[model samples]
Structures are given as C-alpha cells and as structure tokens.
Target chain A: MAASNEFRTCSVTGLKVHLPAEALIKANAVVAVVFLAVGGLFGLLVALTRWQAVHILPAEWFYLLLTAHGADVLLFWVIFFEVALLYFASAILLNCRLATPWLAWVAFALMLAGAAIANVAVLQGESSVMFTSYVPMKAAPHFYVGLIVFAVGTLTAVGIFFGTLVIAREERTYQGSIPLVTFGALTAAIIAVFTLASGAIILIPTFLWSVGLITTIDPVMYKVIWWGMGHSSQQINVAAHVAVWYAIAAVVLGAKPISEKVSRTAFLMYILFLQLASAHHLLAEPGISSEWKVFNTSYALYLAVLGSMIHGMSVPGAIEAAQRKLGFNAGIFGWLRKAPWGNPAFSGMFISLVLFGFLGGISGVVLGTEQINLMMHNTLYVPGHFHATVVAGTTLAFMAFTYLAVPLVFRREIVLPTLAKWQPYLFGLGVAGISLFMMGAGTLGVARRHWDITFSDAPLTFEYPPAAILMMGLNGMSAVLAAIGGLAYVLVVVGSILFGKRLDAPDAERPRFIPRLPTTVAAYGSAGTLHVPGTIVLVTVFFMSFVLYYFVNWKYLSEIWPMR
Target chain B: MAITSPEKRVWWNEPLHRPEVIWITIAFLWGLLMFGMMVYWHVAGRQNLSNEAYKVFPEKFAEKVEDMVAKYKVREEGATKIPVVRPPPGSDVYVLSRLWEWWPILELEKGATYRLHLSSMDWQHGFSLQPVNINIQVHPGYDLVLSITPDKAGEYTIVCNEFCGIGHHQMIGKIHVVDKK
Candidate 1:
C-alpha cells in the first residue's frame, strides 16, 4: 500500500532506502556535523589551555569553555549522530518506511533548540559548573532546564526508533531476528532509555532546586544519580559504535560474524551489565560503602569485560575468516596484510578496534578496580583512558562509517580520496600519542582538572617531577597534531559531501566509486569452517599487553604506599 | 518470512564453532582469575582495599578539628598560623575540608595506626594525598574515616582532586609522618 515515491533502491547496497528515514538521517547527520565543528573548536581551545607552555585562557574562561567543549562533543555531536544511525538501521536497512516521521522531526527540533539554549547559557557565563555539575554549587535554572529539554527530545527520538522497528516487522522487511547490525542498534536504543531516564530523575529535581522550588539538593544523592546518566551515555556510544564496526566489516569485507549467536549474546551482555560502570565514578566517594564498591567493581564487572573481549576476538575473527576464505592463507598475518588498507572505512575501523582494546579496554579494567582506583581515579589518567575509548574507539569508528555513508547516502563521489585514505592514520596516531603522554603524566600524579600543574598563583606550592612536566609537554604537542588530523577529516568529509561531484549517471556508467576505489564489500569468496590463526595471534598480543600493563599499574600502586 | 541474506541464516542459528568455544573458555578463566586475585588481596591485606569508612555528623567533625587545631597552633603571623595537629600514635584524628583549603595540617607517628576522619563544610571535595596516592571523595554531610599506619616518615602533599570551585586547583592540604623512635 506504500506509495511508489516513498522508497527507492540504493544502487550500491541494493537495499531500498525509505525516503522519510533517509531525510531524517541526513538532517540528524548535518546537525551532528555542525555540533562537531563547534565542539572541535572548543576542544582546541581547552587543549591549548591545558598545555602548560600555552596556558591560553585565564581561569574563569578556562573553566567556562571547558564546560562548553565537554557538552557539545560528548552529548550533542555524538547523540545526534546516533539518532541518525538508529533510523538508518531500523527503516532503511529493513526496507520499510519510518514510523511517525512527523514526531521524529519534532524531536529533532526540540533537541536543536535545547542545544542552542544550553550553549548560550554557558557562554552567558552563569553555568560554569562542569559537566559533572555536582550540586550544592548550583547553575542558573535555565541551564538545568535546557538539559532536561534535550533529554526529553532524545527520549522521544529513541521511542521513534522502536516504532520504526515495529513497522519493519509488520512490513515484512526481513526474517530471522533482523540483521546483526540492527540487533546491535536495538541494544544501544535500550540502553538509551536507561540513560535518559537517569537524566530526568536527577536533572528535574536539580532544575526545581535551581528555580527555588526545593529547599536542599544533596550532593551525594545527586552524584549517585547523575553518573547513571553521564557514564551510561558513553555506554550508548559503545554499543552504537560496536554496531558500526560490525556494519563496516559487513559492508567493506562482506564479512559475516564468526558466530551470529555469540555476537548477539555479546550485545545482550552489554544491555544487562554495561550500566554498572557508573559505579566506578562513585567508588571512592564518601557515603558509599566498600561492599557496594567491591560488588560493582570486581566479579560482577567481569561479565561486562568478558562481553567486550568476546567482541574484540570475534570482529577480527570474522574478518580473518572471510580473508582466509579468499585464499590468503599463506601465513598467520597474510589475511591482515591482504586487507584493503587503502580504504579509510576499513583502516579506521581496524585502528579503532585495536586501540579501543589495547589501551582503552585494559586501562578501563585497571581503573575500575576498587583497590587500584585509589591511585588513578580523578587523575589525568582517567581522561587518557576515556580518550582511547570515546575518541579513539567511538569517534574514529564513526568517522570510518561516515566515509562510507557519504558515498552511499549523499549520492556524491568522494573528493580528495587520497586524503581520505590517510586521515585515519594521521588522526589515530595523534590521538594515541595523546593517550600515552597524558596517562604517563597522570601516573606521575598530575591533577585531572587543574589549569596549572605548577600552581604558580596558589598559596601553597608543590612541584611534580620534571618527567611529569615533560609528559604534559608531549601531550600538548600531540593535541596540536591531533587537531591537524581532525581538520583533515573535516575537510575531506565536509568537502566531499558539499563540493564533491554529483553522481546521477544511469546504471551502466555507475561505477561503485567514481575515483576507482574498491567500494564493494569484498564478496564472501568461499564458506569454510572459520580458520583464523591471524586473529588468534593478534588477540594473544592484546592479552599480553593487558596483563603486563595491569601488573605494572599494581607495582606502581605498591610503590606509592611505602607506608604499607 | 523469507530472510533476505542466506549467509546470515547459515551462521545465525548454527552451533558455536571450535574457535569461539576455545576463546570463551580462556576468557572465562581469565576473568575468574582476576576476580580471585581481588578477593585474595582483600583477605591478605595486600591491596589498598579499604573497608572501615562510615558516616559522621558534620558538626562533630567540626568540633574535633577545632579542638585539635587550638591545641597545636604553630603560631607565627596570626593570619597564616594554622595549626599542624600532631596526634599520638594509634589515635583518632580529624581533617576538616572547606572552600579553597583542607584545614589543620595533620602530623602522624610512623608505624602506628591512626583513624583519619574527613568531611567537608561547604561542597563536595576530594581527599587526594600525593606520594601515597590515596583518593577519597569528601562531602558536606558525611564522614569518611580511613585507618592508616604510616610505614614511611615523610611530608606528603594533599591535593583536592574534585573540581570544587575556581580555587579547586588551589585547594591543598598536608600530612607530616614523623619517626616513631
């Protein structure tokens, strides 16, 4: 009963793209980019301020801009892209119309308005209470209201995602439990409900207090509730980006997961257990018991770790299995050697998975431990750890997906193809350097939020070892390098989308990519029973790195407590 | 309902392949090992694993800190003449936290237990002692008491790890662990 114009076949993937869903996706993506540009600018400023040599911003402006940078990047840009991805996964991938298209637009408008209001409030210089915004120290009422409005908008959008899935089911889009990518998006959407609800639970009361409706807002109560929103927002990113990883593998390599059930179970584990990571923030906080910390931080937390490890092994395993099937079975790493290194989509996803595992994953486990958190919590090491996860893992993966999404969705031939090819390495290398140097400085006891480590103007004085200063200087240099790489990405991606040549040719001349890159998902050459010694060796390296790093941190901890 | 992709069907409901089984098993064992280590460390006192922290009234903490400071004032200029409280070995001690500074520098005897109490007067702050590297979040309404027996005698710097205010970066405290001879 659907109208003819409502859907059209995509020449590249051969899947029908629903017009409503595609429009919504494009809208969200365009907005996401604007936020990214603003956020990136703020990020550069914050980085320069953090650089001891630069020390660009004065104290008040330093904190105000820091708040803006965090909100724009972490909340605005990431969530907008995710909502777009949700619609893509549900409607277009399922070859069904988007449910409640009008409602979806309303939600987008609310989110945009909310973001504008929040940004303006921050710039107006009333709400410099950082992203954590631990209370007793209150912001203007409008700031909390803006956040609540944004959260409600996001909640409505997530509802539309579920509605789209229901339409996909009724329209008979596909059979047998949807695609693995859709399943993973579903996981993200499920977690988004928990994340948004946590925001409402805490922020509404905070808003009321700000407006003089309430007498007192307890600090401990606020933090315990607030982190459910804060930390789990990243959890949503993890699930979404992991889905993007699987989708990239499928699109670029024509790779099927090694075992769909195992991969599905891993996503399920994320839904059930990943939210517990919020406790890591509260682990050292007063009014929380050690028993609660031990329960959340240790044995129970391992199930979630196991979930990620399963994914780390399986994603590469899927790639290796597909590669070996292509007759690249010469040596342990022949498959990896033979991968499409020229494609940014493939290269970025691969780097994201590797660093996300080695640096982010291992350091996360170490930082989450109750005993070890004593040394690393609230240090520069914490940000170093998350930069690996959010920046290296999630943002890089999103950029990889965007490269493919542009050519496929925007119907434009990618301009500056050569720059696109090398952008991942440039950005990934710079980000990796930032992570290492910051963590090194943190390990030597640099403060997490301090504008000046030297404490030049403070009443009391203390000096960090010369090495820690050197590490921070290296971190500053890395930030500049990473900023350049970020510019390359913005230029190449935005340039390609806006200024690239339009492709409107008929079927015969419609090459997959105009510049003659291998754009198709390399076919499943032959189905063989998974033989992946390459991935096995890589996983082993990951394991060895993890164990060595964990022990090294413990050794460092012991040395700090000489009184013991 | 026809599933569009046959390859998806080929692997979706199929049994776990050999490699996945092996990986999952090793992963399970490794997680178990980490879990066991944490438990063993807790039992053996080989970790920074604290278990004795509890809540106390802010007024009580305020009174104790005031008494200790009055008893041990290192008087020079009255403005900066904040006392460095030296409680005897294995006694109860208090450290009060407020805006811009952690109050009343504490001196403890080496190799003896002192139950150190912490609370904030205004907002949430962090108790981050350097060189020793222990961090605890201090809040206005609750007390966090940590039992410590200093095995090394040295001056340790205490930095507030939480972003309490503009002076958050300036919030500093001190712990002087003297020889017990």
Candidate 2:
C-alpha cells in the first residue's frame, strides 16, 4: 500500500482530469452544510424565543429574529443544501460536470446577495413581518425583493441542473438505467422546478405589493398560490430526504434494498402527487369550495402519502434484511446487534429513520386529517411536526452523510472521532425530546407565535390537565438539550473544515462495486416489484385521503352548517 | 465510487426472504396495534369533549332576541328546547355584526348553552374563545357554532385567530360571565 501524492491539473479539455464525480458533489455539499449549520442556529433561537415563558427578545427584536429564522432555515438552508444534492446527483453521480460553471457562480452570487438583503432587513426595524407575512401585514419592500432575488437565483440553479441532465443524456452516460440515487435526485429536481416556478409567480407580485405598486391583493388568492410555493418546497425536502436515505444505505453501508424498482417508482409517485399534498396545510381555511379542497387535499395528498407509507414499510424491511445478511442471529432486535453502532454514518441513519417514522410520519398523517386539523391548525403542534421532519429527519441524515462526505470531498479528516461519534446521539435524543414535549403541549391547546399568553391582565386561561404543565416544562428542558447538541454539531463540523487532515490516495480513488438489482425491484422488492399486495393497500389509502378532503370541505364550507 | 467489476452479490445487499419477512410482518402488526390505540384515544377524547352537549357558544351571557318578523316577540325559529338563558342576564339580545371586528358588547352566564353562531358576510374572521384558547374560523358562507360552558365566572377576552387585517392584533372581544341576576 503506497501513498501516492500527485498534483492533477486541468487537461487540454479545460476540466480537472482526476476529479471524481463524488468529489464535486461532496464539495458543493460542504458549502451547503456550513450554511445549514448557521441557519439551524437561527432556527434554534427562534424556537427558544417562541417557547420561552416570556420571550427572550424584546417585542420588536422577537419579530425580527422570527423573520430571519424563516428566511434562513425555510428558504436558504434547506433549498441550498437541496440544490447541492441536486447538482451532486445530476452531474457527479450521473458522470457529468455542470453544464455551465459560470451560471452556477451567478446562482450562488444572487442567493448570497438575497440572503444578505433579507438578513439586513430583518435586523433593521423595517421588516417585522411574520414568516407568513400574509399580505397586508406589510414588511419593508427590500424584504420582499430579497425573497424575489433569492428565488431568481434558485431558478438559475435549477436551470443548470436541467442543463446537466440534458448534457448527461446527450453524452449517453446514463446508458443502461439511471442509478437509484440519481433517479431520486432527478425526481426532487423536478419538484424543485415546479416549486421555484410557483415561487416566482407568488413572490414577484408580493414584492410589488410591498413596494406599494399594488394596493389590492386578495389574501385568499395569495394564500392558495403561496402554498404552491411554500408547501411544495417542503415536499421537495421530503423527496430529497428519501433519496438521501437510499444513497447513504447503499453507497456507505454497501447495502442494497430487496428491490430497486420499488424505490424508483416511489420517487416517481412523490413527483406526481407532492404538489397536491399542499392542500393539507389549508384544510381548515375558510372560503375554499368543498369540491376544490376535496380534490386537492383528500384525493391527491393521500396518494402521495401512500407512496410515503410504501417507503415507510419497505425501507425498514430492506434494512432488516441487510442486517440478517450481516450474520446476526434471528431475534426480535437481532438486527440491532449486527448493526455498526460505532460508525457515525450508520448510527445517524438509524436514529434518523426511527425518529422520522415514530415522530415525523405520525404527526404528518394526523395533521393531514380534516377533523384533526381543527385542533392542530396554527398550534405549536404544527411547528413541532415540521421540526421533527426537517431537523430530526433531513438534517440528521445530512449530518450523518457528512461523516463520509467531509473526508471524501474536502480531503479532511474529522478532528475528534469520539466527539463525532456521540454527536448524532446527543442531537437525536435532544430533537426527539423537544418534539415530544411540543406534541404534548400542543395537545394541551398551546397556540403558536403569541407574544403574550396572559392577556389583558386576565389570568392565563388553559384547559389542559395538570400533567400538561409538566410537559411544557419538559419541552423547555428539551429545547436546552437541543441547543447544546446543535452547538456540538457546529463545533465538530467547523473543526473538521478548518483543521482536519487531507486524504492521500485510497479515498481519492472511487471504489468499484457490482451493480445492485434494477432500481424498480430495489424500490418494491420481491413483492410483485410493481402490482404487489401493497399497491392495493396504497390505492385504498389514496381514495380515503380523497374522501377526507371533501368531507371536511362539505362540513366546514356549507352556507348553513348543520348545527341544529 | 465507480463499479469496476461484476460480482455475485451487490455491496451490503439485504434480501428480504422468509425469516426476515416473518419478523417484519410481526413488527408491522405490532406497530399497527399501537397506531390504532393512539387513534382511538385521540378520537374518543375529542368527540366527548367537543360535542354540543357540553356547552353552547358565548358561554358568558344569555339573550332573548325579538323575532325578525315582529321585532318585539321572541322569534320562533322553532320551539323544541326551552330557551335557557344561563345566569339569565336579560331578555335584550345584543346582535353585533362586524367583520375584522369582535363582539365586545355582551353579558354572560356561567355554564349556559348560548348558541354563538359566528359568521362573516365579507372576508374570513376568526373567533377564538378566551381562557380556553380554542379558535374557530368564521367565513362568509360558513357559520362556526360553538358551545361555550364557562366553568368559572369572570371577565375574559376573545382574541382573533385569523389574520383578518392590520387591526387583527387589536380585534379583541369581551365576554362577562356574570352571576345570575
């Protein structure tokens, strides 16, 4: 085993001859990881401010931080990371380089400028608008312009992604079949295209409204279209999360699912139905006709959920099968025994999957229901649900992938392995604790974004049992733990980026392996691989979600509600 | 990483065969059971506490409004359940109508079933019950009927939950759940 240090330079072709596809994506991912870490801090601060018995910030400052948190986490952190992943799959994973390097730089510059504007406006007293900022709750014009600018940058980024795909197709690099990871990323990019398109549609008008160019914009219409952008972006997050999961399990663990086909098809389903699922957010809103609500909410969303549930069942099934193959004796949790708990990547993935299922998935389904939305709408439970998904699910997965990504891409070794090993556990436990506490408080009728609960010198009126107060306190403790865990993650990641050792050779070489089963089979597995028993169950679920949408609309939107 | 050579098995490939299949099935069944219990508990609790039998809307005061036709006689929409003016504030019914506004002029009763049918003829409004923190949407085409039963008699504020407009923060309604006069 000889360590070879060779400096590779640009060839006559004007591209680095030795740079691997994985290395490029991983490099892009590093920038995304840093941004996500900073944005997550803002997220944590906002949560603290919101949950503190008394707000941590002055009334005015509280609103500013709120704006920053939303802009950073919701818009910048998630989307940028997703874009990096998109580039990774399209260019590197698909054996191609970015179509135009200059366009990528332009996208980055515009996003950076937009983020600066949004942040500055937030810090200034001019933009105190809440994250929703729903028209008429005016913010400074720059804030809206900043949002528009950022969205435009994202559009350019997306154009580059498609360009890569076109270039890849033309080169015939994806000759046989698309890799599962690329397939998943392609689906996410498609979602992003629609998502960004909706953003341009809504935000340009909003920017004009902020500038006083438009005096009248119907709040209802803005809301409907806003979900097309806002909620659709979240769906992109969800799709990217699943795609990342497959990549981690297969690439890192050398584990292929029972079938690739099932996974790929599920990715397609996500593309088809994710946009429609946005109606879940508006289930309890007023003035939407029953027909429209029913069609979008119950029918379309349920189909998307069915796709999710299929993945939900199949992913774990595949993992269990993989564990058994590792030669662990068959017991209830024998698979756990064989699992590489010491490995940071494996542990993070494990914890992420568990939390995603137990917390995020369950909360999403319940909140998606029509009648249930009545209690849950605008409650702390709403944020709690998303936090579980975005932070615990997607963020954790990203952190886990970083264990492999940092070394592979930046040629840097993690500074402290021991700290790195425990980072996931600390963070995972803290997130789970916080989410649970939030869920409990939500059950007790805790509202969201209220500056003060003890209103008008009246005693704080609450209907929760005595136990719920304890839960709220627990929620506070969980917030503290989460803050600590988040701090640790930042330290570890930043330490590695700045001071970690450079890799020599083995890591530089892309390890070769046999092709797994076709993604279609890997997706669904031995069970029909297409029209399995699970498909029937999925169809029923799709219809049920469809019916639920109509039932809620019919009950809530009727001119004369049956209250006699 | 690139695939250089073909191998018999894929990297860390996990195949779901009979034994693994049986175990997954059992675990899924257990999950289903737990899910069912959670659903049952949630539904049962909501149904019992939220039904019309619990209380009526505007749990504070009682009112007897004149018929729409006569303006003097109590309008007979129908006569089934006797009008129970809880804490029996008065016979004068205060019907205040305002969108993006709240009904502050009201006398209340303790544990009285006053059918508070909240509706907005224009844009959507939110009627959030004070103390309980329960908020419902009020739309032009829809009426949100609430049964309010105040366990304690006191002055409480009803805040708007929906973002009606710039005045949403100030759109506060008052309800005095007075002792029987």
Worst 10 residues of 2 chain A by lDDT: A1-10
lDDT, candidate 2, A371-461, per-residue tens: 4566566666777787788888888887777776565455567777787788889889988987887776665556555443333332223
lDDT of 1 by residue, A1-564 (tens): 468788888876678888888888989988888888788777777777778888889888888888888889889989999999999888877888888989999999999988888888888988988878888888888888888889889999999999988877787877657888888899999999999999999999999998899988888788878988998899899999999998888777767777777888999988888888778897777667666776676537488788889999989988887667656788899989998888889999999999899888998889887778888878888889988998899888998888878877787777788888888998899789888888887787787877787878766777778888888878878878777878888898789878977654554334233223243333332334457888889888988888888877777666555321
Error of 2 at B73 (Å): 18
TM-score of 2: 0.76
> Taking the true A–B contacts (Cα pairs closer than 8 Å), what share appears in each candidate?
0.39, 0.04
Docking class of 1: acceptable
lDDT of model number 1: 0.81
CAPRI-style docking class of model 2 based on DockQ:
incorrect
RMSD of each: 2.7, 9.0
Interface RMSD of 1: 3.5
Query: Once model 1 is optimally superposed onto the true structure by TM-score, how far is the C-alpha of residue A467 displaced, in angstroms?
Result: 1.3
DockQ of each candidate, alpha-carbon based? 0.46, 0.09
